[model samples]
Target: METQDSHVNSDETKDPGAATYGNFINYYTFNPPENRLGLIPEALLENLGLDSGDEPVLMLDVGCNSGDLSVALYKHLLGKNASGSKLHLLGFDLDQDLILRAEASNPFPRNIQFIPLDITDDAESQICLSSYLEKHKRSRFHLCTCFAVTMWVHLNHGDTGFKSLLARLASLSDYLLLEAQPWKCYRSAARRLRKLGRSDFDHFKALEIRGDMAAHAGQHLEKHCSMELMQSFGNTSWDRSLLLFRRR
Candidate 1:
């Protein structure tokens, strides 16, 4: 693992245009957490069996940019825990500088943790995520929330990688609340890189999976991952769909 000094010192942390995998350094400045929070209803979370379990409730936040939404969601759920069940949330992203900011501003450091991890790294992710599960005496998280991350993974790794990500997320949690970026967003990201004079995403042009990515994700999770779509919480400001799935 790179030290804080080494991670934050990188040029990528200082410049958003340099980011390769859509992990923008200053992500929340343009898209505030409050806007995203407004779309999620409290009733949607209460129906997920989180508060019903006798054991501790665990939530995983993938691509938690600066941990703002993770902290907000944690506080939201904190109010729903009428059973007095202990709740813990683990948020991770590939950007280390963002993780540093998250850690610094964290008011509930004991229950909410932010780490720098690349979920695409199979061995490392398994070890790190599994270790967190082990410490809580659990095998999988109760719920996993991934907001607007699928496009970057798909554009970078191609069609196969996108399928693998869906399978992996399904295996890690009983419920997955996903917000997949639409096809237009992919085009936008690619165009941004080109405008910045950076090389295009390698797999973007070659990707076989195209159009209605959220629906595609839902199909893959249902057919290949033994998961079924439980609900669709509708689209966000960017027109991305928040689809919730449950392991069958």
Candidate 2:
């Protein structure tokens, strides 16, 4: 599938810090039926065993864009259990405008809320996020899923970012779902683009030198064979397996 070639400066447009809000606006307007946000929320709720009547779980849709994922989760809960149980779904993004738009849409259930968070710095970000989890200990999250967000870490911090993100997700979830584009796609695209003189591959390599090499470059770089490893994750050995890890 051909993706839009964004002319905006990657440094500005792809800023991990900017994810606090809606970054997709830079690419597309907010419209329905075509967006994939609904799929994630439904899948997450099913995976987490969250249903109606129970106290809402503390769901964190990291890299939530325009709150579609959050809406999807709520919709799933509403559909499964019309008992009107409250849901405490918090979405974090870098852009305030996106947050406002999400609020304006008001797609959340009465119990849901959205917040702005900068995930670029793990140490500080975790301290804050963990605090919320602590206060809401009664509502242990059944699920924590980061969709299309790992690319930011892999692009900026390379494997280090990936590991840090994994550690955090492990702390907050009973089940987790993480997805990423194959590194080779980025590498191949960069090579092809450079050959055609469209853009310098150096920009892509700066984020990741050997792997996808499209996003992360400055920090130490290496390929971890993640796409291969994550493919065999779940008990049944499904390709895109949902890793069910109990809290240790």
Candidate 3:
């Protein structure tokens, strides 16, 4: 796969121009961990069948920022002693600053290994992933969670980037808990912002995973982002999930 090695600083401050509605996600428009906008760690563990003590399993938080989700995963797994499994959690991010902050915070289990990496940058992400896996080759992750991340890429790299990311992720985990912003929501936000003359960003386009990466994996894909699905998940639910192609 072709990879972009150019060290693109993803720091929101580095490029004010990039922070357009195209780059600025409503979810991350405010304090992140404090807001808990992405309750991904919990939902992912639930899907992974993590019950106390099942032998320390390998867990990866793809876009871990300040280790909030990493900490949540650790706390949740620790709460469960189902099989007495030890957890070897790995958190990766494109921002070195966040990785440093996560390391300094030390919020998760002592076993967690936080690394500076970016998924869009294939060489680094793959190397970091491979090295971490080899170091703890005993177990593979039972589940992986990627939430509110694809849209950011779609904004940056277009549909092709989103599809590539999904394919790459599918190759890495048995099951995935993906939480993406429905296109309607993005569109609504865009129109509102435009009407207010708040921003000069492109109109949000409708995108769905079912016909995209989900089809590629050939797994039963279900969308629960609609009103009914949202209700089931809850009004306070800040995220929605799609059980992506299952690894049979």
Candidate 4:
């Protein structure tokens, strides 16, 4: 669970979390790095057989708010790396403030990097991500993790936008670790907006893709994105499933 001090500090500035509102500025305060780390299997990345052939193994953390989880995951993988392959992790968030904080607090400056990016902007995201890949002489990241980030895309961008996110990540990654927010979470998010006296998310009610959100994403990845489910790391404390997929 999140540290009491962190949670208290976050609550001091917490937003209503509406779609129109920016993301929870200090998200890891409520959903701590340890809680997120507990659900992941040991040596998960190493087990994926990621052999970069002398180059450092590259990983991407999507929606990497505040970089706590990204930092934790990098250390976890680095410590247990039996093959002694150098590891480089890149974490990005749409929130420039969050990314700035991530960069400021980052411990492993050489191995981990944080940048601000809005993944839904196809051209911008593609160009930025492609540039990173090109710099490292890598076609795609060895692993990509998108935890508890789908709802915002779905609620704000509609069904089509949701699918597009999954498809794009799959294209950029050899393996994907996704934690899509469930349907009830969507209702709760919508309700929170209502409670805050904010207008409803425009794309919420019209979304054709509803119910079992993780499954819907999985199906789309396999059927439309040429990816296959590899395994499940089980559910997080928030009752969100952590699923792993690989490009076919």
Ordered by TM-score, highest first, the candidates read 4, 1, 3, 2
Estimated TM-score for each candidate: 0.89, 0.62, 0.63, 0.90
User: In every candidate, how many clashes are there?
Assistant: 0, 15, 14, 0
lDDT pick, better of 2 and 4? 4
Model 4 ranges with Cα > 4 A deviation? 1-22, 80-85
List the global CA lDDT of all models: 0.79, 0.49, 0.51, 0.80
Quote the lDDT for 106 in model 2: 60
Query: Candidate 2, which segments miss by more than 4 Å at Cα?
Result: 1-22, 26-48, 80-83, 138-140, 188-248
Winner on lDDT between 3 and 4 is 4
Model number with the top TM-score = 4
Tens-digit lDDT track for model 3 on 174-244? Answer: 66656555554445445544554555333235444423332322232222211011112221244334433
How much is 237 displaced in model 3, in angstroms? 2.7
Candidate 1 on 181-219: residue-level lDDT in tens? Answer: 888878877876776676898998898889888889999
lDDT of 4 by residue, 114-211 (tens): 98888888999899999999989999998999987788888888988999899899999999999988899888878877876768988988999999
lDDT of 1: 0.79
